[model samples]
Each structure stands twice: as C-alpha cells, then as structure tokens.
Target: MAQLIDLKTFTDKRGNLTVIEKVVPFDIKRIFYIYGVDESKRGGHRHKQTIQAAICIQGSCRIYNNNGSSEAYFELNRPDKCLLIQPEDWHTMDQFTPDAILMVLASEYFDANDYIFEPYSAV
Candidate 1:
C-alpha cells in the first residue's frame, strides 16, 4: 500500500510553503512533473527499485496503485497530500484537471533499467 504523507507546511499571510525532505525510506535523487495529459489516458507503469512521492501542485488528479494482492486509490488534490510509492507497486494516474501539475520525487536518478514493465495481476 502507498503511504499518504502529510508534508510539513508553513503558511502565512503572504502564501503557503511546503517542504520536501528525506522523510521517506530513501533520499530523493530525481524530480519531475507531468502536465498536459488528457483525461482518457493514464500513467501505466511501475518501477522495480525506484521509490516515488507524487504530489499535485496545481489542479487535481487521481492515482490507482496495486501491489499484486492489495489495491489503493489516491486523490492528489493538495501539495501536502503526497502519495509515497514503493517498488513493485503498479500505479496508474488519471482524472487530471486541465491545468494539473503532477510532481514526482524519485529515490533514484533517471535510469531506464529501473522500470518494470512486466504484466502483474492488477486491474
């Protein structure tokens, strides 16, 4: 199951700030974001060793994750509402708003070998 992490947020009259640290099991080595995806499409892939924490910094989206035996759904609406994904967990992202910005913090750097495209028993 993925962990729903409520990240540290500091708010003031000016604006709000959220901090991303090494609170997960591994240090963040790569950061990326997804945008301009249609609602009919989704992220249909999983990692073998890389862990990720996904957040919606702008707009909203939904994420579905499965780990062979169990499944979970997450609504990434706020920047502080982070979904910490572990290895071997299959995930798909969809239901994105028009201007949604999905940010991801990865435990490892960009490596094509880290992706596991094997078919798992997930629906």
Candidate 2:
C-alpha cells in the first residue's frame, strides 16, 4: 500500500516555505523529477528494494497504485502532498498537468536489478 503524507509548510507575507524532514521512513539515496509529459503516462513498474516518495512540486498528477490485494489512486495537486510508495506497490503516474513537476525521492541507488517491470500478477 501507498501512504500520503502532508509536508509541513510555513506561511507568511513573504511567501510559503515547505520542508521535507523526518516523515520519510528511509534515507533518500536518489532524487529525480519528471516534467513536460504530454498525453503520456509514467512509472509502470515497482521496485524490489527501493522505497520512493513522490511530490508534485509544481502542478498536479494522479498516481495509481496496486499492491496485490488492493488498489488506490492518489491525486498530488499540492507541493505539500507527498505519496510514499513501498517496494511492493506497483504504481503508474498519469494525467499530468502541463506545468506539473513530479519529484521523487528514492531510498536506494540506481540498480537495474532492483526494478521489477512485471505487475504483481506476473511477478
């Protein structure tokens, strides 16, 4: 299953400042961002050992997650909305707004063997 975490934000006349602190269960080892996607979806697979937290820092996107027994859909429309995806959760991201910038924080370094391309049923 995937969990949604709201990041802490501080607002003032100057602006708003959001922070990513101790909420994530693992230490982040890789950071990436997705943008400029038009009519196409992303993330069709799940990891074998990595955990990821995704945040739409600019616009909005929808995430569909399936973990063998259950399924869930998450709309990340705010910068403070963080979706934590576990290793077993097979997820796909789509319906991205033009300005959307989806940032992902991963718990493990890049390893081809860590990725499982097949869905839960095939795996």
lDDT of 2 by residue, 65-111 (tens): 99888898999999999999999999999999999999999999999
What global local distance difference test value does model 2 have? Answer: 0.95
**What's the CA error at residue 89 for candidate 1, in Å?**
0.9
Task: Look at candidate 2 and tell me the lDDT of residue 24.
Answer: 98
TM-score to true structure, per model: 0.91, 0.96
Clashing pairs in 2: none
Candidate 1 overall Cα lDDT vs. reference?
0.86
Model 1 spans > 4 angstroms off: none
Model 2: CA > 4 A from native: none
lDDT of each: 0.86, 0.95
Candidate 1 lDDT tens digits, 1-123: 788989899999999999876567788889999999885756677888999989999999999888787888899999888899988778899999999999998999988888877647745
